[model samples]
Target: MSNQHQLRASVLASYGATALEIEELLAYNQNIFDRSFSTLPTKFPLPPEPHVAAWEEYATLAQEIGVFQALSSKLVQLQFPILEGISQTQVYRFATRKGVSADDMVEATGLILQQPEQLQLILHQSFVGVIPVLLASNREDFVSLVQALTMRNEPKPVPDSMGAYMVTGFNNWDRVRQYRQQWSAKNFGNCSESSWLEEFGRLILQKHLYQDRLIILSDGFYSNVSASDIGLSEVEWRRISLTIRLEHECTHYFTQRLFGSMRNNLLDELIADYRGIVAAIGHYRADWFLRFLGLESFPDYREGGRLQNYRGQPPLSENAFKILQALVKSAAENLERFDAQYGQELRTLNSQPIMLIALTYLTLEELACSEAHSYIQKILDQLRTSLKEAEEHLKSKP
Candidate 1:
């Protein structure tokens, strides 16, 4: 067999399955897919709407047949490659307010049980977005998007979480070692160098063992930090930022704990990214409003303005990096000028200096999606014209 096939067989071995078994699973999946797409449903039920026939049929097949199970199993296995690439010394950490231990699995499971509805909703969203790809007549583009979305940096903590995980690890070696030891003790074989979910799973196990409510305090980028309180059972999943976390701390935290059960990494990251963008924008705008009212200080301009305005919250560096990469220098320069023009207000509002820049770049990406070159050129012209107007506005300033 080729090396590639050997590798696949090796990975499958962990599940106590032979190569033939894996192939059988693959064949089964293909058959299901063939059947599923053979008769495409006319309608799909979106959220808040009653489940339509199409929705029920798809959902039933996905959940009941071994499709979801097989996909989920493979996703977990594929996570090894992705997680292995990340530095373990860089992610996850135990929360300060409440530390966890191996004995806490029972309690942690209860918290998850109590919030089963939320978890289900997360699954539904993932299914909605990904099923189209699985069901698509021409699925190459959809598959590519799914891959991109899966790899996107959608989680990570608020600034404080980062400080606790990464920065603190650098400063507090003893505690860090203890934390890692505790993680290992709790997770054992499941913990990995780059698996944030595994570390997160360990935390959950520890939290439950200790019967602590604060175990799930850190909020991922995808989570809803505000409406999180609406649940009566009193479950707290706090938002933690990546900046302050140690290299591997958060990765380990997320991998074993939360990631293990999640079948769709692509949708998971998209939901998180969407939520992160909304929160960052909201926070940026709020800071702007606050500055207009002379109520707050400006955000830090050099360090992405996160420190200056948001204080404890920062955009995921990965997303920031992508935004920076997508922009042309001229477009980026114009955004800098725009931010500076409203410096006092922008600073007051806690806006990241990069946000406006990122948004403009995103607009450029949206423009690029068109197959018509003329359409793209027109969009570029409009952007240039808008920038020129902004420049004129700036020039007229005293």
Candidate 2:
């Protein structure tokens, strides 16, 4: 069965969403869906497992249900359905990096276990990574955080409203490490030629786990990375995956907020990753960009940034490649401008939405300048001129 079909079947079977009920609910919209219900039982076999695998099915179900909820919950609030155990408040998970050292362990655990008040204070300060996702959600899942960002005083405590999951639980260090390793066994990939992602690290996505809530997932990884490259020591587990990966996902939040939603857009991916690298390390470096893209290679290292590596030619047309090259060049130059124009504005953008508006246009370049937002056209205009000049230059080549 198709993944979509399987996913539909899985969600319903697992969640007790019997086909009859769905058919009744959706009959007004379309009957085909009602008639094509899978013959699977109403309940899926097996209880949820301790591993993330247990949550996988639920994740799909939640996301799908969340989408439906987003579209119809307001109109049908009283009739809106709920997941089995997901909470109503927003949940943001923070996980240990694959290389999380004992020091980080102590810091996180100390805050959580030893100093509850301080931990609450810090989390409040950090604003948690998941908040942005809600604000940027196209599904309109979260409440406004604009007030939270603007207020300086200790904002009203979220109390038990927010939740977190440390990727590597600290209770049993060895057992946690073993479980993490086993978990990452499925998350294999390369970071250049040398860096091997043996352990998983980084926040993957901001997903819906329950009603009007979010859940962040992470894994730890062991990679042979130079401490000097990202400017860390030999044992900084945060280097392995925590800092860079989390920052990247945060960028996804940023992009989603700026543009509408993050779809299958290559420009969005590159821009997000680029901004993420900058957030983690203070400045944008081309080598870091290349390494993150798995475009660089060295024999001694294990390619670490990639989760899955594609071989052979990239799936891009020549024209598309040219456009991408121009964007990459623009991106390289903009790296220096990151701190000046883009970075600060990214955090707080009242006057200048150009940085993001420009990116939105770049992805939707198929739109005529007339059809596109003026600011987007203005952004793409410069790139178009540059690309045209390069094109003419290539044609004039001897």
Candidate 3:
């Protein structure tokens, strides 16, 4: 075997791939023959105009909702879905008669951990730009709220493993109402909702509502792994897990706002998890990441491991699936090594933005290859130079 072949064989062996499986992977040969990595951009792209506008609008809404204030006095309440045979009004009255405050009602309905006042609207500063974040402390509440908001108040089943949800181009009904009134006056010289106006509103106005983007985050253990699993106390683990979740979702927000594409894919997950891990603990742990993806035992993937979530659109064949697992394992190990060597230098320069920008240039296949280190190092060097020059330019300004 050639040196490249020998290295490939070695990786497959380490992951406990059977000889037959190795041969099948070699035959598939997608990763083996094609090793193209994109050239890194000199600077990160600016956030798109629409994204910037959306952030501003969300900030205004947050202020209007008193998101920054303490939770004691706010009486914000969401119209939670009514249970079977019970009117929503009755539910509210029952809770009120029982002396349940609005906050307690929300909590008792499993829509949030505490009062609705505790729901914070954070304008998180990210490399792309400031993105709005709706931070929820409870996992159950996070799932339900996301379903309600994104699914038109429908009671959809949300997966327990999902800790964060991104809301993009979400219609603000308040804005929709204002737009409808204006449109009605312009078209018919009246603001009343006639039958024709209602039909038009249903078909057309709904599509044109002022759209916004935000992330709904849950403060759950990263990948639902408890503190005991990672050898940490409950409090410390919860804190770190929240940081990881926030950073992970922010990474997605970064890509969505800048690259204009976000998908349910392993490569995206890998990149997000890398940023999340580094942000939380200042280093990458391949084992922890693998565990998060249900690859801790390699050949035997855990039943509910996150890896099952991104099996591709049409899904991969069994042979292809095995090969994918091997690739992911190799890629993760390479990333961990890269972080260990360059993490301190990157952190010293506060280079997360540039780092994330550089990472977008490579693929999982390229990262899994034997030359992965060289490929990443080349991009990092270019990004570092750009970052330094930008800093120098800023310093010269004042």
Best by lDDT: 3
Instruction: Estimate the TM-score of every prediction.
Output: 0.20, 0.33, 0.69
lDDT of 2 by residue, 1-398 (tens): 35434443443333343555333212211112111112211221213223333233333444556522322222111121222221121220112223234333221211101111111101110211223122122111111121112111112332121111112111222234444555556545533313333322222221221112222322232122345655666557444444555455544444443333543234554555555555565555655654544444421223443312211133343333333333343344444444344455444422122333345433212121122244344654554455456657667999
Per-candidate RMSD, Å: 23.7, 24.6, 8.4
Q: For residues 1-398, could you state the per-residue lDDT of candidate 1 as single tens digits? A: 25434443443343344555545322221111111111221122212212122333434555654433332222221112222233221221221122322123321111101122222101222111211112111122222222212332122223321111111111222233345767778878866876645564564444323221000111232121222322222222222221111111222222222223211122122122222333333221222222211222322123422222222122224333222222212222333344345444433212321222123222222221222234333443454455466667668999
Positional deviation of 57 in candidate 3, in angstroms? 7.8
Reference-based lDDT, each prediction: 0.28, 0.33, 0.67
TM-score for candidate 2, please give it. Answer: 0.33
User: What's the CA RMSD of model 1 in angstroms?
Assistant: 23.7
Q: In model 3, state the lDDT of residue 97.
A: 29
Clash numbers, per candidate: 59, 22, 0
lDDT of 1 at 184: 76
> lDDT for model 3, on a 0 to 1 scale?
0.67
Instruction: Name the regions of candidate 3 deviating beyond 4 angstroms.
Output: 1-117, 176-209, 348-350, 384-398
User: How close to the true structure is residue 171 of candidate 2, measured as C-alpha lDDT?
Assistant: 24
